[model samples]
Target: MSETTPVSELNEAEARAELARLAAQLQRANRLYHAEDAPELSDADYDALKRRNADIESLFPALKRPDSPSDQVGARAADGFSKVSHAVRMMSLGNGFDDDDIADFDRSIRKYLGLSSDAPLSYTAEPKIDGLSLSLRYEKGRLVQAATRGDGEVGENVTANARTVGDIPHDIENAPDIFEVRGEVYMSHADFDDLNARQVASGGKTFANPRNAAAGSLRQLDASITASRPLRFFAYAWGELSAPIAATQMEAIDRLRAFGFQTNDLTRLCPSLSDMLAHYRDIEAQRSTLGYDIDGVVYKVNDLALQARLGFRSTTPRWAIAHKFPAELAWTRLEGIDIQVGRTGALSPVARLHPVTVGGVVVSNATLHNEDYIAGRDAKGGAIRGGKDIRVGDWVQVYRAGDVIPKVADVDLSKRPKDSVPYAFPTKCPECGSDAIREDGDAVRRCTGGLICPAQAVEKLKHFVSRKAFDIEGLGAKQIEMFHGDPVLPINTPADIFTLQNRDASNLARLKNRDGWGETSASNLFAAIDEKRAIELGRLLFALGIRHVGEVGARDLALHYLDWDAMAQAIDAARPAALAQRKADAAEEAERQAAASDNRRARVKEARDAAIANSDVPPAAASAWSDLIGIDGIGTTLGLSLSDAFANPDERRAFDDLRQHLTIVSPDAPASDSPVAGKTVVFTGTLEKMTRAEAKARAEALGAKVSGSVSQKTDLLVAGPGAGSKAKKAADLGIETLDEDSWLQLIGDA
Candidate 1:
């Protein structure tokens, strides 16, 4: 009988008995996989068992067992290590989805600290490693025991196998008599590939990915098998200690490395939340390039003193977090594909998906990105990926990548139903009925509709009034959502936001009674909106929803242009060159489109010429279109986007109309001789009195551009608390490190 036999085929007692038996077997298998790195079953067989367990649990929810293999930890422990109890339990972090989730986590942390809403705090960030956890014990400069991080309370012993790994040191000079180090065990991509090849050659089952391979290798019942597989370790935490080692977490990591344990070289110390985000982005950009697999980054407070005060939450630490990367990839159906026009005139392809949950988010749509994404059919006439196309109703895989955007991956041709049909990618904009054209050297199809698209208008308005935009107080997301749907509000554009002042009070008075709002809040919001009738030039530029012009870009534009009128004039004048270049680029792209359109070679030339002459680049307006790129921050891509937006006569008219209603404010210019100007400071180890935010803000006030994650360019590191990985990375890179007091002295605070 198959392990997947349904519970309906057996009596309740038999089902329960089978479940118990399977649960035990699964647990043993998991122990071998996670703790010992030795697996009797293949990856496919293990997955099958796991699936069976999941099915049984779903069928008998009430009879579910607590100690099921599903509940066991993932993969294998670190190599060349011994098990040791954590000085403080190293718990995993909770995850966040959108900015709201992040904000909520921030709020909860503040509440735990008995802080008010505005109380400032600093944070450190690092990538969360996707590997097994292990504990290593050391005795007076000598190696001792290594064990898997079992249930926080008890773990299975694996000291003998751990000793065979080469990266871990057998002894350290002047080490404390007793201490435990904790770290992750993982396989590099190359090692995983080589190990899998060896397994295949030896007539053994191959591993799936590095994570699976490492897990399988670490759990072997026999020590020799583990010794044969290539494994690595990165120490991140300490368990128990005979005596005090480092004064802070950063120092602890240094001590671990000094004792000869392999640790991650990219760990960073982020003194504030903003710096932490920057670090996260840096790590994300390097994710694919990194040799080893990283599920996410781990962040720990640099101040050990603060950490000791805040301590652990239920399962994780209050002073640390695991910022995870996206990983929800599964095969589903690509039911249909459609074109969407954005406010900025960029056209994108959207896939109507057979609803699926990826990375804990329910996704029914995935972005195809551009025209280049469609058309090319695989052998099955489905979407050729890499160079493939997918058809309607084809079973396609989707993944919700780190940025929360979902995209199509592949198709299961054999499972595709006979009724499925080829998907027709639209040749025109769906929102405004404009001709969609593929530009030169471009992979996307853009709508010639420009500013008239309802979809574009609504999205733009939403962005304009967003908290980071004009920050119009009373106009929250719910309110904006209501305004988009209501005929009375008719707030369709940024200009429409100013028109809302003339709206009847009855339309908005109802909001005062809603949740999280009151008369005071509502009135305050209206007041805030009124106050922003005039805004800093940078904020207005960003609020206009210009493509690629984010906060930094806006700041640059403001710095160069000085005011809104100047900025607008520059863009208006540069429209001609932007238009000509776009047309030129479009002519080249049409060739690719022609090949994908059908197999007719003769029609390709004719289509290319005609499309170029009538490309998505609208006609430019004299000198008014030649000055947009004169500003420093404007790039070719942004210039092209702006030119496209203003090229349309209607869009130009709208821009003029919108320009009349707003007033732009100029910020005070900065002076030279600022103390912190041109200096890069990093924070490491522990800080005694001031919060990380205060330190960063003070540095900024003195004109410093504070960056997160130490690098060669990093001038100083302000360390506090459990500043582990970053300190080590900084030291390795020869970056200067500063304790909190030294930082204060350098800044003249002393």
Candidate 2:
């Protein structure tokens, strides 16, 4: 498209079409740059495209597309890597372009908190390294996992690769039992030069830059390759800490250094915005001589409490921003579009761009979110860019800035090919040819192929064996995929996994003799599988990979049911009752639709309510729906997911088949020796000696069933300061009441 045509000159239809094209183009560029380590445009060109897209979107605010590139942070996780979900989602930082931008950021923060200009707000300024982000998860002072920051919420596990980096500690003394240390994994300029020289001498491919080299080396499937590369790590932030590391950002860095992790020595605490700007300039001046690549300076609010109060925006923290160096830009051609299916059955659209260079990196692909995104429509069906749409054979601008993925910045409409047509989204799953359905309130359409779809099946199996599920010792995503796809040793379902030993025994060919396996390993795997044969009810439920039944929901269900057989029986009985209730409601609705006499409608409604109240549910299942919804944290969404899974005939048969090969262990009841054993208890207000979580854990451990609200079943009430309705309810019921101190004394902790 010609740059001569002003964005304002474009009509509503033209703007909408252009916005759709730009959205698709930019998303493709993101995938290519972030996930594939390739770029098709320079940083400046990409920025220009983005600026143009923003201008049009501003003029036509009602047409802002849902898949706007400005809203996304990173691309989806690439294939061949095991995904790791972060406890605390890793977020991207907002950018500051210049000194004025830094001042604006400071002013914005102060305004958000209603603080005076002279208020003493401290910040920590550190160099923002141009490298890959890695999160090291430690449990009980031992490094358990190391993962790359894939898409904030989920990442790729790279523990083996991370272990090879000398700066990353394998163990830390006096560290919190559960902590996630976040930092940059980078390569020094000297090391990069040396590695490239060695590669040339060996006739191997050489890296274009230190950042790319470090990323490629760290993401290697082979640990030996990562170990051979000279990689260094610097601790900066943390996630999912068991306890507070320090009160301020700088102090937390010191704590990290004390725990044997390397921290940037240049990190400084700035008392004011001017001090932060000065530090940023100093870092910028020394950037070339720092031995490692640095893109900019990051400033974060020092006080942990203040940081917590500031909280987060849509995709970034309000407490911090990354002031990046100027971006580079370039132009490229839109090649084609492709669709990829994810583990969760989401069909993402990808852009194939003519290869170009942006910021010394090559890019060729980008992300296009979904159908609405491609059509210049928002997730809620609003027009984006006045219904602009992207088409093939269009000249697109691309750009990239410090650490951000390359993206399509704009489209040159003047160069658009006449024959190009608006892209049509597929209605059927490309992988399995099943009907692709988009649920209400969901942005992406998903394939309903289930087990019949190879992609969905493999993904489900991976989730089934994930760390939070069955957690089989030797069976990981890679092994599960290999076994499932193997013709001779197929593991198509949960039952198949259990019957593997039998299948192997029946055949002369052994798993032990296979590549990457031995007698001990095979035996150990079988032993692990056997150990999991008597899996806990909670874990079993989670391992089934039921939609919306997360670890917490599974645990709640298990605790309420206690016994496997009893839970299954209740579920079975509740399914029919739920059906009966639905039928009765339908009859009442039909009566109302018929415009029957008021008396007749009233009678129908009464009968419907009575039938629902007296549905055919076993005693244990009579209150199943109510009890499921009543559990603390259990909501209607999760309750429906559980009930639907139980009611589905295919799912029920699958569960029965799996149960035949394994024993589902019942969850243990609360301790019986304590004085409060088997007694339902409720805690109201606040306890001074301990937090609510701690109190609940202690009570459960001491055999008390801690209810959120006081009820007729409650035998004891522990009331602290500000005890209100719950305490009054206990007094009304004549249940025994005790102050916090008195409750502690009764529990033998006074």
Predicted structure with the largest TM-score when compared to the true one: 2
**CA-only RMSD, every prediction:** 17.6, 16.2
Task: State the weakest 10-residue window (summed lDDT) of model 2.
Answer: 1-10
Write down the RMSD of candidate 1 (Cα, Å): 17.6
- State which candidate has the highest lDDT: 2
Candidate 2 lDDT tens digits, 1-750: 333234533444566688898788778876765576666654445554666687776545545788876666666777868999999988988777668789999998876665669989999999998788889999999999998888788888999999999999999999888999999999999999999999999999999888778888888889999999999999999999999999999999999999999999999999999899899889989988999988789999999987886789878899999887767778889899777665556777777788887666577765566788777788756786567776778787766554233455567778889898888888888999988987544688888776677877776777677666777888876688678868888888778888888875643247877899888888888889888888889888988877777777787678767777777776665665556655566656556545454555576677667766766656555455555554544655566556766776656676888899888787776656889876777788867776565677778788776666665667898999989988887889899999989988888888
Q: What TM-score does structure 2 among the candidates reach? A: 0.51
lDDT of each: 0.65, 0.77
- 1-750, model 1: which lDDT tens digit per residue? 323233323333344576788787777776665656565654434444555565555434434676665454443333534344444454545454334445566666665554567655655565677777777788887777877766554554677777877787777887778888888888899898898888889899987678777766666668899899898888888877788778777777777788788867777766556676678778889999998888666667676766776676555676776665655578777777766565556676677887776655567777666554566643333455555457777888886444334667777778777876656667777878888776555455666665577766655665677556687766744466566656655666667666665567574576477677788886776677778888888787777776777776676557555776665666766665566556655554555566677766665666556654654454444233433443333556766776665566876676677777778787544453655565666555545566555665577677555555555556666787789987887789887777777677877897
TM-score of 1: 0.48
TM-score versus the correct structure, for each prediction: 0.48, 0.51
Displacement of the residue 650 alpha carbon in candidate 2, Å = 2.6
